[model samples]
Target: MAEREYTAVVYSTTSGRVIYDLDLADDPEWSARINDVGGGRITVPLQGGAGTTRVREWCVPLRYSLGVLLGDHVCQAGPIVPYAPATDKRLLTVGFKGFWELLNRRVLHNKAWNPASAKITDPSADIAITDSLPNIARAIVDHGTTWQNRPGSFLPLDLPAVLPGTGTNVRNYPGYETASVGQRLQEITQVDSGPDVLFQPYLTTSGGFRYIRHRMLIGNPLLVQLGGALKFDYRSSLVALSIAGDGSNQANTAFVKGSGNEAGTLFGYATDTTLIDAGWPALDMVDASHTSASVQSTLDGWARADVALYGTQPEQWQAVVRADAAPPVGSYSPGHYADYSVKNHHWLPNGLYNYRILGVSRSSGTPRGCVDHQLQAVRTG
Candidate 1:
């Protein structure tokens, strides 16, 4: 009914080629969507952040590389299962921050002068970080690049990674002695400090990756109150809102038991009270691989994560809004604006509430360069 005017730019960092002028009216077939929609319902999987329980995945297509080329050299391993398209323009092309994430995922060195296939070695492959989950997750994603380019050909993949330690921490290629540049970054964010920590990698307004931990974008919230010119569609578009669990409640406390990895027989344990009410309780937890955190800390970590994730019921609010303004709200690029919280004042059946966009969707398609704030109430008591 309304005339749509917007542009989408797909760039390849490796090739430094930009394909622009992608207006919705130009090609209706080349389109994308925010979150995901099917059967008139829009749903988003768990995000990566504190108090979360799953890891987000980044799988290459059957016959395509990721947005950007990061590994030493890529090749078609062989005929892969399923089916891979001959070409996908989206592959091997991405913005700056995404490329940085890929480069840091793995360690690379050039033996000769700019060799296509460099001498790749990873010192952080076999051992898990044990320091922080984010660091450990980064290590895994770094190595995952190598896996994407393994000798054969595999694409359209969805690799899942579990918690405590990445599933692919101690990785080894089928016939090779070393590991690739990726590790399992698949897991939910543990919510001990605050709510709205993402379980998957989100995109900041600056086109950089947003990890759901700490207070990065919650300083000042943008209010979309009455008459703010906010645009949304219930039936036609794929926007979803719902509530789930909360894991930060006091009743969410539980017992954790562990033992030392040394010669003698050493054991330790703690309850919900000792871990929840008592912020920093002393518990003996020692191991050869990890010692930076105590046994009680680890247990407390899990308890907090559980409570924040599944303890209290969480309210999820998301929408695909539009702005007829000059630069669409979804037209995100670096240095355009800072990552800030967005509150949508709504008229609900019960009453009106201001829900913040706690976690966001990094990948979104725009009909008029518009995007949706995958909003979840930060304080849902």
Candidate 2:
């Protein structure tokens, strides 16, 4: 059997990277030409050496070496698709509309990844009561809890009906359908209303302080089946229906009160309402001036209820506070800071001593303040 012969060639690129030839053959003439023994720009036949019988050829190394080196730094290969600002405008508008459509459909209520029966568990039954369009509308007006069993009767029917620029009509409404994920994504990339609508909620001065509460549920058997310890950055922000300190609206005052400067505080002191001051050291330090034992007790009760509702090991649960803005007085930067933790199920006194104050901003008029809460199980691994 005859062995294959190949020639190797080496060269340098403008970038100073050394490259080697890929196509090589063990041909003496080819090897000599490629080696450039005399270091000449052009290979010349040896003196009187039978005028170059064969030509040596080699592959360039620069292409492959530089290609591999450049690959790592690049995010996407090939020509980039240009994005126009107008396209972005279209996407935002459609994406917003699509998002609301999906929200109205209650698509977030059940996961397509799970079986219908499994996805629609007892919670589904409970949610269904208020899930109906009518009940949801009622919930908006009455500010009352929806009973399980009713369909198409939820709160804020106006929410799903009102279109852009149209006057608020709580009664007469327009029906819009929810879009699928593909449709939503398409709307986000294209400028057409092919799938969704883009709109922003308008918050009027009449609206009061909105509180957003995110409950992280962990250790649920059903949740475990989907995946152990689900982490959801759930958000729910509500506003007090009436002005604080007003006797006529005492029931609503439990959340907030007063129309103007004399607004009475409910659910605790003013500092308690500020997310940054809600956690440990900050809370405890301020307790002397603003917080009462009753306030601390209320926080503890809320924490316990959260654990009971979500934690698998109710006793092992921990709470981490995230504030939305700078601490009124602290050396901490105006950013998220770990301000609290529960050890062995013991609820820390002062409710503020153990947690670190994480500064965050909640200036956005939206009722839901920004905060992320992750529920995790103690890992044995």
Candidate 3:
């Protein structure tokens, strides 16, 4: 692997000011995901110098964010959480979670017109909102982060005031209050063709760090499908590849129960006839506790999504590849499609397969920069 320089910069999360740049970083590893929070870690030599003391003092959890930069671009960054010294006491390792983890700290509150003093546990008199999914997600985030609704949850950031080309599947959010924002956001993604609510961090032109909520609708044009020009081949770019097909979680029929108790519970079910016709046995998966869904279509949507995501046997691909390969490590995000071709596999067909990128984990090589990237993907076609 070729040698490259990687710097770890700790900055204030509140003011976005550079705090300190670590002198040395060892064994840096990071992973990012569109569905949930991503994280990374690095180890630094603790020589008991003034610099080491400064690192110990300023790298407190939540107050500061650690950014791993390759040249000018910030490949991964997050708020520092763990700072532990080695057993030999010669080196200190630090870890951080993605900025999106902040959402876990606050809960969705029905404070549509309530005063700032309103308590989260207090019953809200505001009626449930009926709007598009993207708009609903934006409202949930804004209510949790804006100062006018709640002072402590204020985050000075700019998000999409209006999501472009959002889904028309209007949903209801009646039980949104009291649930953690992170949990609710994830639950909303269980619907058929739901959008991915991602909290992304970026470096400003002036070198400041900031975050934004990006709503990525399913099957949107921004979700690029890479092949031909940008492909992953076993001979080049890919160092290793493995495929696994699991039927343990497979369900030919999916049942989604929503918003009720006992006999009054609302229910919706979907079955994959293709799988059934393919001789797959009757397998059932029940998804429950969608108390926010009041409409029948919303329940049906969840069932369809469950069936699509878990109804059939799932093929997962794991690949170890060069970070600087054709498309590069930082070029594609989750939800994008890429062609993966392997010529001579002992048990599989020798051809190109289209896969959806799910998550990515990259680690620094012996020379220090990120050189190895491992991808987790699912067969989409």
Q: Pick the candidate with the highest TM-score.
A: 3
For each candidate in the order shown, give its overall lDDT on alpha carbons.
Answer: 0.28, 0.21, 0.65
Model 1, backbone clash pairs (residues 3+ apart or across chains), number: 59
So what's the TM-score on candidate 2? 0.16
lDDT of 3 by residue, 242-343 (tens): 677777787878888877788998888888888778786788888876765667888888888888877645776666666665777667666666677888
Task: lDDT for model 1, please.
Answer: 0.28
- Best-to-worst lDDT order: 3, 1, 2
Candidate 3 global Cα RMSD? 3.9
In model 3, where is the ten-residue run with the lowest total lDDT? 212-221
Best by lDDT: 3
Clashes (backbone N, CA, C under 3 Å), per candidate, total: 59, 48, 0
- TM-scores for all candidates: the values are 0.37, 0.16, 0.84
Model 1 bad stretches (over 4 Å): 1-16, 19-125, 128-183, 191-300, 324-355, 358-370, 378-381
Write model 1 residue lDDT over 60-154, tens digit each, in one string: 22121121110211101111112221242311221122222332233322112122343333332233343344434343443443344443221
